[model samples]
Target: MSRIAIVSDIHSNLEALVAVMRDIEAKRVKKIYCLGDLIGYGPNPNEVIDIARDNFEFVIKGNHDEAVAYKIPKRFKRLAAKAAFWTRREIKPRKRPGYREQRVRWQFVHKMPRSEQLGTWLMAHGCPTSNLEYIHDNETALQVFANEMGGSRICFLGHTHVPGIFTMDGGEVHYMEPQDGKRYAVTAERAIINVGSVGQPRDGDPRACWVLARSDGTFSFRRVKYNVDAVAERIYREKGLHTSLGDRLFVGE
Candidate 1:
């Protein structure tokens, strides 16, 4: 197996996506997997989806993606709901020159699966069973290991927008924050790895977060800096998106 890159929660920030893709390319990673949320809460939904469709090998259906593509009811807050609605309006096919292309991209998002199994690893936008679930604590991690792993030794997730590693061995579970460029050996009986967010990082660092997994049973977290102010300004200029969406980029909240 070749080394692969895992990214999630892009949230349509074109600058962050471009910067992360450049970093991935520089690392010589050939395969990239996306955990979804390709749109919503950012200014460039269509552009982000274009890049994702062109690059990622597979993309799991996230809550935001689901809401936007299907117009399904989700537990989004006021701002997120507003953004999702706006994204729907933005990506919805229209009677324009690019109508065919737009419909194709919309269908691409609409057809994304909820979960994918890669050899011994399971990939999901959140937990295996639900894209809306958040595996944020040891208890939730243990629950996933017991009930949701579906016979995989490792599960890769990206809904919390915070990078961390959870390992279960000898009937004990341990959680650790992943550091940039530090490779963590995948020796646990079961593990859940959160690759964090690519466009809207909430880990307080503000840089885009992703993970590089090697064929040698180890993975390292990577973060790349981009022009946050530019994206924030774009968000502010967009009438449908709220200002807080852009403001959060500066603080990584």
Candidate 2:
């Protein structure tokens, strides 16, 4: 089976991204798919972009990424807006190198569709229709599944930062704990898998979010432990980053 890694929401935590990559390497995975938000809410935004540009096979844009390339309006949650603003400043030429490179990639942010369907599998950062929607729970899944249900047998989603599986088996929903690196075979029924957050987790779990897909339509989920303290300290040290962002690393909320 050819396993490809699915990573999302690194949010500029280089330590976490590196740790997750180590986990991927240990599994011998080289092909990677990114669900966006590589920069935001933490340090080393450029480093995250560098690694992704060098490694990822497919990438979708996240709301935070779009906010940076385009102007984020006041309608966005102020906290998120603040983080995007701070992240843009932090990744500037003086603070972070590779701004031009990142910007070149950032320009593609707007072009990323809200969702992607590859044969039997679909991929998206949030809901199929909205990049900013949060598919965190079963209710959200029900609505999204109903809309995107088609020939595609499975859908992979992120942006909720809570890793879990929501399966539509004969019009019923069953939620499973994220697969711990073992592919869970799928039937003809549809499924929506939230890949979770890599740098920052919010499912009362501090580990990073991940997913693995094989050529034969088999897939798995992985959440690896990284240096949370290192990420927390960096955010705390950054002048413009809010304390709440740093403090959440401990709670994963």
- What is each predicted model's overall lDDT from 0 to 1? 0.92, 0.78
**Span of ten consecutive residues with least summed lDDT in model 1:** 69-78
- How well does candidate 2 match the true structure in TM-score terms? 0.89
Tens-digit lDDT string for candidate 2 (11-106): 988888898899899878868888877777887776787787788876788888878767886677777788888877755444356657756555
Off by over 4 Å in 1: 72-74
Evaluated against the true structure, the overall lDDT of model 1 is: 0.92
Error of 2 at 14 (Å): 0.6
Off by over 4 Å in 2: 92-113
Q: Every model's Cα RMSD, please?
A: 1.0, 2.4
State the lDDT of candidate 1 residue by residue for 66-99, as single tens digits: 9998765656788999999899999999999899
What residue pairs are clashing in model 2?
none
lDDT of 2 at 25: 91
